[model samples]
Target: MSGHPVLTMKDVGVCYFRKRGFLKRQKIWAVRNVSLDVRHGETLGVIGRNGVGKSTMLKVMAGIMNPDAGVITNYGGYSVSLLALQVGFLPYLTGRENVFLSGMLLGMTRTQIAEKMSEIISFSELDDAIDYPVATYSLGLKARLGFSISFHADPDVLLIDEVLGVGDAQFRVKSAAAMRSKIRSNKTVVLVSHNLETIEEMCERVVWIENGTTRAIGTTADVLRAYMSQVKGRAVPDPAD
Candidate 1:
């Protein structure tokens, strides 16, 4: 699938310091044994419950956070990401400035960023608000702009968080379309979204994380069906027999 895998993870685990006792510092593992391969040109959907370390997985992929165990290999261009909602934006800066900042972080020259500025603005659909301070924009708008900037970077691997819920309905549609365009370009996309329908539609494969561990990894339809079945019976009240 486009030569070799663009991203590979094996026995990857993340741990954080919990407390420093008189004897030692206790650690907590947020995710464990997350070995996965992201072949180029494929979308890998990671779905999990809230606070289940989905964001931490993406961070590991992006090299923002290092793992306590296991190895991660990447044989592609740099991993540019919009890992969290509005993560890369500076509130005091205008949307336009953030685009350049993003490009710089992605290792682009100033001229290169300028070349794609118009495209990002159009894709984000923030024409009127582009020059305004980002803090003035809504959460959805922030997500849209952040995504547009990273999308235009044309990275080999793109890690997107749940920011797809940003923007108005029409803008959301546009963002989804842009996402499809990225997939068609054969870029490796690692998407973390709570919208199960979007996951089913966009992902070629799904990895279901449960309790900070990979409980299932397979076809989207199969995983979703099993996950829903497990979730459905849990919330139902017992009938008065």
Candidate 2:
């Protein structure tokens, strides 16, 4: 299994239902006939417009959803899905307690979380707020805490949905550095973002998805250049001209 891909998909497909009637069902695909590979120590970036199933693809890899048709093989262990920040979070719990709970769900024990609690709080910069109930936190604060907790889990594969929590100018610079650091590990990271520059900087390879299908896959520079060219031509007509 040493040579096996960290994650592999073959002829994958997923469909959602559109209500025609209570008894009759209609299907709308979120991903169709998509095949790809993610190798250990590499970051694979998936980009597409809204509602194009970017998050759905990551969920399938994270084993959150069973594809309608396809084969996904993982040698062993778990993959972390960050599609929804703090997905299983309990509002009643304090941020610190929630972090511990999240770590445990990721397969760690109390002792394990005890070993990394300080690092988690420190990295999140939550400090005193860590004792506050998560339900009382703002969206940004929640996102930050969730990201911090996940980082403490020591994931083998980290699937991130959006870079919303990566913050502003200075934070983005720092976040890019963090993304680079993650890619260097013997782990797989699959990122989905609308941030073209972030994708270009962090990913060596890319998969272009459009309308539930893989439109293209290739080196970052080439795929991105194509994406930009397509978008540039569609720029609104000049009113002055």
Candidate 3:
């Protein structure tokens, strides 16, 4: 990665309002004062237990959700997108139709979607099913189609949630290869996953988040070592170890 930052978050925070029935409501902060930078062509992994606001941070970066505090700056006119399963699909629409719809939602033009339809369908392996309504698709099918469309969208910055965990073994391998191809093309990626091994393999750096805050951020080895130590209920090992 170069010295330039593609995207940067400065003291960002997001909150949700939960209603408890009658007149009771509570304000919960999903993200808290998290600051980080995403550099060009770097694959940054975010590893954490569920409900730690990692996904929320991606939403903020993708401009889907705004932070209640702080700021997110985008440099170089980069386009950011969040790729997650079971999203961006219109249940009543056919897979072909949803391709256009979803692509548009991801900021692609109609002409671009038309041009890439064949490649998207082939990559998704949805052949005949591409004509069927998305609601009729199985879980794995949804993941395959969603991932194919997003991966081919060619965004400047891609924020991947746990969608990679959804597909079958073979498809996972294919998808991982596609992601590597994107990385090779010098695209910026922010990946959030429960699989630390994949994070270690795919990411140059990893961020460990706990309870809506950054627990550690550094090289993949350093951050994952610290994260795994906590997971196993042991003290963090020395860097030399």
Candidate 4:
């Protein structure tokens, strides 16, 4: 890690309103007071239980959604891409078309996407299905295409949310290998996952979120130990031991 921050979030918060009977709405804060810095060339892990706003935080970081409170500063104008199963693909468009669309959205030029088109399709293993409309695709098929496109987008900072488990066993292995390659290249990454083992192996630092706020932030071992202690109701064994 270079110890230089590529992105920084200061007291960032996102709110939602849900209907609560007639003329009344319940205010929900999905992410409340989250502050952290994403250092360049480091893999940062985000760990939390379900519904803890992990995905919400990622969306804000990717600029897909604006925070209702606080500010986010993107130093050096680094490009960020969010890798998720539910990629913003036009259902009516073919897989090939969606690849171009998603790539452009990630800041890739048309010529760049065109050059990588064949590789993306081959990596996805979509074959002839690449010409088929995405609306006709199964969940796994869509995931394959999404993963393929994002993998080759080559953004400065990549945000991943529980997408490593997508696709079949073979594709899962391939995708995992690709992600490892990205980390090895010293690309900045923020990973949100429930797989503690993956996080432990890949991330140098971790941020633990609880009740829509940061509970702890530190070395992967330290934060994971504290998180596991709370979740398992017992002490966690040190990795060194």
Candidate 5:
């Protein structure tokens, strides 16, 4: 991968306000003092415990949410997309209609979506269900549609948040293969996953978040070693083992 940074976050912070009675509000910092750079054509992994602001940071990176403090710089004005299982599909809309809706939301032109419509539906294996209302579809069906839409969107920067385990086993294999192909093609990706094996296999580098802050950032092997050591409270295991 090139050393050129495509995206950079400097001391970024995000906070949320929650109602605490009639006139009081509580402030909760989701991300605090996070600094990192994503190089061009690199798959960066983000690993952290639950509720640690990893998802919030990704939203910031995707420009879905602005940071409360610090700055995020995007070089070359690249388009970024986030792929999560719970896509914002209008429940009452048909799967086909939602495909157009979600595809455009992912930065695909309407014409482009039309060109790829058949392929997306075919890949999703929704078949006749493609015409059914998304509200009537099962969770797996929704995931399939979401994955298919995002996969075909082909954004410059792909931000994935635990969407790999979607659908059935066969679909999981297919999705993983597609993601690997994208990564092999030098597409830039930022993956947030709890599956350490997936991170170790796909990511060249990783950023570890703890308590809404960056705890470690380095080569996959090194950072994972430290993270595992701390989590296990024991000496790190040999990779060969």
Candidate 6:
């Protein structure tokens, strides 16, 4: 990894305001005091139970949402792309059109997307369905399209949220290989997944989050072992029982 970080988040927090009654509301913090850095060329895995704010952290890093506290520092003109299903797509548009649209949204120019169009289509394995409206596609199909476009967009930093398991078994294998290729080429990645094995296999470092807070951050094996130990500890029957 490079000496300088592409992205650095410091003590960031995000809260959602939900209506409670006729004249009251509640502020629920989805993530709090979270600090991390995306060094050049490193794949960082974020592993946690569901509803622990992993997705919220990714959204904040992608600039789709602002933190309610702390700050995020972008070193320079590094482009970051968030790979989440159906987040920036138009259901009325064809899968082919959405590829260009999503690619542009990820900071690729028209000509750049045009140059990569064929490869993106081939990678998605949509075949003739690429010309069909996105609304007609299944969830897995949308995920394939989204992953293909974003992966080919070649952003400096990529934020992925529990999306590597999308699509069929064959596509899953293909996508994993594609991600490893990007990493080999020194692309920065932040991946959030519940699958500890994948995290251990793909990440150099891992962060464990719990209750919207960072519980541990270290090498993949170290953090995974700690996280799994805690999970297993919780699973054991209480002595009082």
User: lDDT tens string, model 2, 107-209?
Assistant: 5689988989998788767789999999998876776666666666767778878854454455456555665676666457788889998899778678888
The Cα error of candidate 6 at residue 234, in Å, is 7.2
Expressed as tens digits, the lDDT of each residue in 1-241 for candidate 4 is: 6579999999999999999999999999999999999999999999999999999999999999999999999999999989866467999999999998888888889999999999999999999999999999998999899999988988999999988867999999999999888887899999998999999999999998889988888899899988888888886543333
Q: What is the lDDT of residue 48 in candidate 1?
A: 79
Model 2 vs. true fold: TM: 0.84
Each candidate's clash count: 1, 0, 0, 0, 0, 0
Q: RMSD to native for every prediction?
A: 5.4, 5.7, 2.5, 3.0, 3.3, 4.2
Candidate 1 local accuracy as lDDT? Answer: 0.78
Per-prediction TM-score: 0.83, 0.84, 0.91, 0.94, 0.93, 0.90
Off by over 4 Å in 5: 234-241
lDDT of 3 by residue, 35-122 (tens): 8889888899998999999989999999989899998999988999888665579889999999998998888999999999999999
Q: What is the C-alpha lDDT of each candidate?
A: 0.78, 0.75, 0.86, 0.91, 0.91, 0.84
Q: After superposition, how far is residue 195 of candidate 2 from its true place, in Å?
A: 1.6
Query: What value does the lDDT take at residue 39 in candidate 6?
Result: 82
List the candidate 2 regions with Cα displacement exceeding 4 Å: 1-4, 76-84, 164-176, 233-241
Which pairs of residues have clashing backbones in candidate 1? 140-167
Give every collision pair in model 2: none
Quote the lDDT for 71 in model 4: 92
Q: Kindly provide the TM-score of model 3 when superposed on the true structure, using C-alpha atoms.
A: 0.91
Residues 1-241, candidate 5: write the lDDT tens digits: 7469999999999988999999999998999999999999899999999999999999999998999999999999999999866467999999999998988878889999999999999999999999999999998999999999998889999999988878999999999898888877899999999999999999999999989998888889988998898888786533323
